[model samples]
Target chain A: MSASHPSDQDRNESLPGEAAARRVVLSVDAMGGDRGPATVVAGISRSARKNPDIDFILHGPKDELDRLIARKRGLAGRVTVRDASDVVTMHDKPSQVVRHGKSTSMWSALDAVRDGEAEVCVSCGNTGALMALSMMRLRKLPGVNRPAIAVLWPSRNPQGFNVMLDVGADIRADEKDLLQYALMGASYARNGMNLARPRIGLLNVGTEEHKGRPELKVAHELISEAAEQANFEYVGFVEGGDIPGDRCDVIVTDGFTGNVALKTGEGTASLIGDLLKEAFKYSPLSRFAAVLALTSLRRLQKRIDPRRVNGGVFLGLNGPVVKSHGSADAMGVSAAVKLAYQLAASGFQEKIAARVASAVSLAQDAAERGTETE
Target chain B: MSASHPSDQDRNESLPGEAAARRVVLSVDAMGGDRGPATVVAGISRSARKNPDIDFILHGPKDELDRLIARKRGLAGRVTVRDASDVVTMHDKPSQVVRHGKSTSMWSALDAVRDGEAEVCVSCGNTGALMALSMMRLRKLPGVNRPAIAVLWPSRNPQGFNVMLDVGADIRADEKDLLQYALMGASYARNGMNLARPRIGLLNVGTEEHKGRPELKVAHELISEAAEQANFEYVGFVEGGDIPGDRCDVIVTDGFTGNVALKTGEGTASLIGDLLKEAFKYSPLSRFAAVLALTSLRRLQKRIDPRRVNGGVFLGLNGPVVKSHGSADAMGVSAAVKLAYQLAASGFQEKIAARVASAVSLAQDAAERGTETE
Candidate 1:
């Protein structure tokens, strides 16, 4: 469980949880995780117990969902079950899902978000399939050429996290698309991290202005010029080493590079965690040391746990949708649900749409000015 | 100091240190390191003490170098200091260095290798400047469109390291360039890690053939087809997480992504190391625990220290060049020298040239076959 302040509980108590009170509704795909519906149900129950002004629309097979929800403790008035027959398997291809996934739980979850029944959708399914379904159901926002998936990265910043975009939405983004990602990512940081003006960085091999590919150079100029309109500060270029440091709040890059960097950072953290555990168990003296250092180690582990930050938000869509990790357990799924609730509560979709629109206009104006000069 | 075996010393002694016996000579840029000539001299002393068949051509001002080497007892006869009045400062731009750096220590070091006086050149200067100077001085090997820089990354392999290419050589690599990176990286792994048939993996966001950019798909096919001729096993596409795993020995990628992944991995490891120290110093009980676990922790630290694996080898060049980290200390510099010595002793330059030449021929053949099929 997360460490909650007393003020959060007091605010939750002040808001009524009844349907008539218009509580925020999150659509949940209650199947397709590695651990199945049981974990999803447990995660929803945990969230429902903590947040009083939230409700869920659970999508899955009626019989299986009924059985799972019956075993949970806090689902009497906070859940609405939606019967769906099909499940999107992890092995299903994205193109295949687009053609034959009409009845799948993942599709139905996104449909709820599209139909205005839920503010956001949360799913732990095949990423490609989920992304395809979300794009099909919600469609891209106007002036957005490419949609991006943004995730929160642990950093040394005072806010403890930074936003990185296009983790896996698409493999490539041109200079214009990168500028759009910066604008959208800055908006996400403003809403997610409560910063009025987020510092944005374009990810490259080196921080020097003269370094990196040609597209990055153009993107740097565009993002720098658009920062005032986008309500963000352009930090020029940043390298991968700065991703975990306190230099920038938003890192923008093509999905290919961003996804690789994200996974590489995760893998490195996991390797070190495993090695540390091995070190603590090396001998009797070390085992004794492990016991003495248990509290501090646990605190450190909790601080950097991947399960605590388990969702990648699909930006540039009609409605916000979060893709939870496929192998996530109850804790991970709960983290995703919490992210969905927060985004829905903050109305992040409208903010992102406005930001993208203004940035697109700026880009078009710059293009027209260039043509006139030529 | 490294844990060395008696056989290593025996093999080194048998090779003989005399010029007639063809001792491996390394050209070292002794001016640009943060610690200046003192650290470079100490590093050469360490290498000279360890490998009897190795000699150095140290490039710097002879007056200051003589004073530094005189304090180090083992470096007297093994090092031959070449006086160069000018030094390449870290702040110098690569373009500026290319235009007006004839008298600099870095240029002299690389010139020695180009003139066949040394087998390899090692420098601890600005990376961009060093890379530019190496490419200019050594020239590209036959059929290499864009030369690559291969680095030794700590991994779970039996050799305890993996070879990753194009770390910061060039930002863009097309399908052909990627294939060349694969070939060059495999050669580096064979000579550097002593793996006869090194497994080569193309770095991408996903491992599936259908995933990533169009160029990656073409590269996947090209590298998979050319594996046999390149004398390495192709592991197809690999994700960022695989960089530290045992799935492959060589990871081929463009300079942009490779550099980002390398720095991200370093940053994550540094963060964990810092957190571990914080945990150990939390309280009195933990302080006692730290004392008890000092030996095991020290072993773990030694196992993952970046200094032990210092130096990024510039592949696809006429002669080998290793770039040590700018902030490296004596131990780190010594590690770079040792790597340069091993690579020079193994005749990696000729081997990489041969590998690139053959791979290019196969690519040309494949192109002709494609034209015929069309």
Candidate 2:
């Protein structure tokens, strides 16, 4: 799809200089979500209304998107549609997509970010495919052996969230890759959480120095040495239970372990939540108690609501990209959009690139120094 | 520690024939816990009162344990003290313990099970030290590469808990090791949950067959082929979210992932619970609502209490040895003791040994068959 439309140029020319200067354009894939294009359009409309400075390059079939966008009063002015005839289904393999997914909306959305037309891209498509496409289009940052997906987990910190990395970018990470994750995650925390220096912890089975695999021990040493250079405090090794605690702001782990921990945490919270509702509805007495406790329960629910933190940012990429949950509704999608907007506005991608470069050099220097000492 | 006490012989001789036949002696390590010998003694007393047929060989300094046991009304009759002066501090490394922990109560406790004086062993010591002692004393069952620590996680299953293996055993598991874990976990489920045939799932980041590391793919094939011979249904691959769901009765994963997920699940639950309490105590209205919801809240609290399920059973060893939390109180210790008693009474150790032996043979057969086909 071409971007040099006469109407688009006219609309941009009509905008006041200050308003146009402040605009942050986000590329959004309107296809591939389980809820379909209508939800995506509505989610974008919700974000556009809330944040006047945000603009969207909506990628999907033009006819359908135009009809959907017309239903929302103020969304038409902020949204620009790019027609992509094909959709990436959840069943499509990442490898297959890379080989032949040119016409898909997911690819087009990522292409917008790659072409510098959008500051960030957001998609509720298949995570594997999205990661694959993003990596192929945006490419990994220099010295980034393995790009990571950093997620915001509900935590006891004053910020109410903690950044966890390598959520599912790749299944394997060597000691050095873990070190990179620590650095990238810390940068994300610093930029996203507005922390001067975030506390980073390496996720292990135990906090003891000698406890866990040999690689973890090596990673511990590497991360410890790199902490000063990376500008984040290393909290040593932390247990999985520390993920949601105030012990660390950035929790780094291999994607395999981090992904499992992430899903396990979500599953557990959901299980307890469902059980609590069941308890409240058990009998007439509990039903009355539930009514009395409704406000407190609502407050608690708002505190732990998964939708409030719905995005998993693809770190170590050339441009910022967010993978919203496949089943995310309008609010969840809006949350992801907001996170993307925040990252794009703050130029987080550039910050992460600089941080990774320095961290890698420091780690190499430390390794060489160790060899010489030995 | 001598087992040939005149009073023990006298008690055995004095018991009625049926009562003596039904008795199951549990070897107890009465040291290394955060609460010390008093809590262990109280825990043993609690278990002894609840089960008339249960007996204990308590290991600790005789002078200290004897006085502690004397204070309990009915404990002296059921508990026989085996003096072990040395204690394995939590700070002690596993390798050091294996080399020089012979004089520790943790070693003596496992030795009791090794000598057939007790059907099972229960200890609230450093997990690494306890596992080391158990492995060194009891030894691994035939054809077992790595021993796994199987834990009971709260689940939505009919049993209210699911068995997850390698919770904090070794941090690594290959395809063969995973197959062994599957068999051992299934056997534990059969005995612990009393299921005729349990559904076993290989834990992964995703349920897709083509996803995850290479070893997991191999494990999926191996476990699938060995399921019928191993007397359990292989439910293919499962994700972290499945740990607390009804999709599987046993979740098998490498210790690194399992331990992290376990701790993360606990941490997330705790974070949410704490937040709920804070929400309830925010104002007078919430405080009044909390009072009204006290019974329901207590029910929920009791439902998820870690103390109720307080044992991590060491599997793939010659006999069952339970590792209770080091910081356990009387209630937690009693819960571990109860699990030990149940497993010992049901001959769980022998059952697991036989199951592992057969499962190992079946796996070997499957591998050979595949080689012949190739």
Candidate 3:
């Protein structure tokens, strides 16, 4: 299956050749996560200072947001504040936010992007809420039936990153959704990583044709067909263990299973590292040995930390809604902001739309051709 | 819910006393894997030699099995090869063998324990065939509705092992099956590990009460009720990350998801470790540092290797059907033999049957008593 898009050959000129291509896009949800505006403001402030070429829009209670950014003088000029009275609580019901919190910090942030005031939306809060809000407000890209939440994971290799999608967007997805996810993932790789054909894997129980539940079986068939039409490369089924390996560039699965698997991997990595640390501290000799190997251990720790790739982009939506980790700190939030800026800068939306449209078109063409032959 | 049967006061037999109360008994399936009967025979010969008290009844094609052991004349007399003309072929369908090949090597192995020819049945052949044959031959322990495959995972923690059941028994299971899994897992902990009150957890997406699919919701209610009855200590729901951390002694889940999660964790661990090893070989300096940490790395590898704990006993069956790994070698087959012997020694069959019967009886009793009280 093809992972690269032939259509992409003509589209990359927008980056350097076009003078206005670097225009800063995307609105940041200030009142999100444990610390809310304080951390969000700091993260955006850091990104803005690092890269003066980007613009930002912070959405939250005007007075509260302004108060948090009061000390950071120039951030207000670089990024505008959109007045929003309400903040969606961390534990707020996903459906409740979509139905009742239209004027909420999260909704307002996404709305700005939907209205073309910004190109992407960043939030460290409810992922389900962002998914619902984005699809409802901005609408799904043409020909894309379902949206997905894609996150960049720190790969086992030092120089690489693994993109895993449908993190928690849809619980029970059809084959069409899986195909859409692959297209979006491949688009991200080509546009962001410049890979000609990104290796894409279906996150499954095993590599066999009949390994997983029925959804995977159907997804495999559709993905293979989609790849045959040159939408994006479709690699075979990949085990959950292969996520951090160099085996696949993009891995896709239904949200529920993906969420559990991702979290488990995170938890296990941290738990093991911590256990080893404690074990090394048990005796003076081991402690001395740990000190000697501290540099190597730190490098290993840096390779697996979740904080390295903090944002999970809600792909296939009309606009980007990068969901920052719930327990994200200042550095994690900053990393997320930078990722949001890249998603906006990389022309991810346009690339995804083109490839997804082609995939859908191919499906329709197959059906039309079948009828004609009949 | 209660994970084990009979209260702590009733089953507090000391380790020494319990050790004296048991005798190692194993039934060997003399064929399977790449090496077939040769590996099985070698493993049996090695284990019996290592543990003089361990006894074995080798059930298979007697003439061929005898030739495999013909070179080891000293140990040949210690092993008794029972002739079974019909042998379960790896290529044969699992259901077909159980339905027609009742005199096959696998069936005869399970039959040895089922009809009291031996205490435990060990098979390196097809698991489905053994599971099916064991059911038809050994009567189900009363009140035990469905059998589950249980494996003890040695975690990074030195405290104790974690018992995970239903790796691939029932594809989809309801609350009662989960409840039975909890009971069976708890029995292993209390009896095997000598834990006074082993902690029990349901494998889930999250810790929230309302979290999880429909099956988990119902199972949660039943598990809580059983826990309140003091059957086995229920430690509440735990996530996938908790497996390697030893957060709970027993974890219960549906077979399909459980199997995926188990393999995923194992794969990820190996993948990460291998990546680290390769990275360490990048430079001469890094390789030197790795040499210094070789002991620690080897210790970690030994702790996480899947092959080290390859055998999983089919719990809730009337008799034993120990399923060795499909990739089993001589060492793995030897491990399976040891596990089968231990299961018989622990009297798991009778213990689990009584536990299942009592729970059903109590539930029915409460239902009838409520009618009178109301």
Candidate 4:
């Protein structure tokens, strides 16, 4: 693999000066996904064709990646293959990965962003391992105690999606960390969803002020106070139903709860979809009905398809990192690549960093006021 | 309303001796729901028509409830309307209800159970207020610390539903409480779902042992230790997806997470259904397809309809209490009534009490062993 390592300098020299200067480079891990490297190469190819200004630094076995990328004309001069001898398995522990995963493709992909060679990193590897490597390489942003992973959920909102944070970064978040999530989530909504002043809601069991855990109550006060300074409207408290509702653009919660909610929502949608298929196949009349309703069914499928929103962005980090679904197909991978490109193009990293910095000071001011009140 | 109170002695005398001896009475609160008392009366009527050995003690403004119950011939000899001067509104706080709600229908309904006049109590009132009144009237079962609310979730299991506890009883639960919930939930599954040996899974962010909050890990060990003695299989930790998956028959968690997961699942299913309707209405062809596929669509709807399983049972209390959906229609309320009748018929209260008692001793033994080990 080391002998087959391709020269990035040669690839850079081959690119036109104007195109190379205008393109935003993305770091992609080609191995460790449930589907293998072919899907990753296909994804970058789709992105390359769709956005001429997007380029990729794909990390994997150099010989394999070079052959895969060579098959796509659009990705010819747009992708740079980096050699990584080892790959992280899905079963690898995060702690073990941090200690012994230097030669893995996931590590190499994050290193591209840490070295300032790419604007963003994307991978469909083990989430725990990837987050571990991302924190080790890219580090956390200033004033961010615990980083969060923000994902887009299909919603009835005008933007067609709501941003939910801490979908499995760390399982626990205190009042201050939740406040930071609110600020960072608002920044994400603004840059990713194009909401000017996103409405932020804290996820809880009920919308009542006096409900939920004690930490959530303190977080409610902190998030409510920071909303005005953070430039996002605070929507008091929202329940789980409000996640896909039009009540708010950003929902903030601890990682454990958010992860469970995300998976539950996905599981339910998947179950309904499966039942729908079984319904359509129940009888010959229904099978004929299915043919007539093919377009409508496909339309519904596309509207709620998990593949359409394939990336969970790792937030509050030095550089942006998007984790694609582990079993993502070519199209799902493409969606993740497209999200990464958009985030990179919007310069979301700098904006989120600034928002988090101001939020830290706002938290300090609130603490001082609490002391005075006591 | 006081003048219109129906005489229970007259109704009881009208029934045949054999029928009265076998009838299991359910107390129903006919106020505080979003739709009001007409739906509640209609629900009990639906249940009464289905089960020959069921009777009801309907609590509400006697004038209104009597008028509603008289229209259903099935409920003519089975219902004894109790006079309740006031109704518990949705806006009433639990604290206020506990202190000043003696005259409310919700309070009167629970009193029937506490007084041993009814086998189970069913309410469609404000959940917080209902839980508070139930606690005040019926008290906790022996060896139970925190009472939990358990609900059935539509799942891929052979039983078609999984029991999840602490959906909204209280926000916090410790290791002992979770262990008790596991025991109580297992008993509910045995009697309610007819599972001889139910498999219980502790809900967590990940199935891995080292994930989630500190309390979950401790609960995991305690529940595992108590499973064999309690006659249920402990399947370790399960994620939110498994709530609707076939991996386990019971999901145990704190009230906060379970409530959120339940609501999130419902919300996601609802959003998809709405999107599906919009898909079928996209064009004239899709409209024609909708007409042709009505039967298939209805079958699918019946399978995933939340109304089909519309009750949340409050566990760990001296008497079983079923909380119908606040916005439930007549059909939804009827499903809840049916569940309450079945639970009463199975003597779920006594079984759960025995399980909780044994679990208490099991927990104490584990604690003593831990002290010795330390």
Best by TM-score: 1
Classify candidate 2 by CAPRI docking class: medium
What C-alpha lDDT, on a 0 to 100 scale, does residue A347 get in candidate 1? 66
- lDDT per residue (tens digit) for residues B3-64 in model 2: 01112322333332132444778899999999999999989888878777778899999999
Better of 2 and 3 by TM-score: 2
TM-score of chain B of each: 0.94, 0.93, 0.86, 0.93
How well is each residue in A1-374 modelled by candidate 3, as lDDT tens digits? 01222222222222221225666556888886887678888888787676665677788889887887877866766667889888888678777888998889888888888777787788888766777777888898888777888877656533367888876777556666777788788887766556767888998766766567666776777677677555467878987777777778888887766766676676656655665676566566656657766766766766666776787888887777788987788788877877766666677777777777777877666434533543
Which pairs of residues have clashing backbones in candidate 4?
none
Fnat of candidate 3, please? 0.28
TM per prediction: 0.95, 0.94, 0.84, 0.94
Off by over 4 Å in 4: A1-21, A370-374, B1-21, B370-374
Tens-place lDDT per residue, model 4, B60-153, is 9999888988888878878889999898888989999999998999999999899888889999999999998888899999899999999888
Name the weakest run of 10 consecutive residues (lDDT summed) in model 1 chain B.
B1-10
Q: Would you give me the overall lDDT of model 2?
A: 0.86
DockQ of 2: 0.77
Which has the better lDDT: candidate 3, or candidate 4? 4
Considering every candidate listed, which one attains the maximal lDDT?
2
DockQ of each candidate, alpha-carbon based: 0.75, 0.77, 0.36, 0.74
The 0-to-1 C-alpha lDDT of every candidate, in the order given, reads: 0.84, 0.86, 0.71, 0.85
Error of 1 at A243 (Å): 0.7
Query: Judged by DockQ cut-offs, is candidate 3 incorrect, acceptable, medium or high?
Result: acceptable
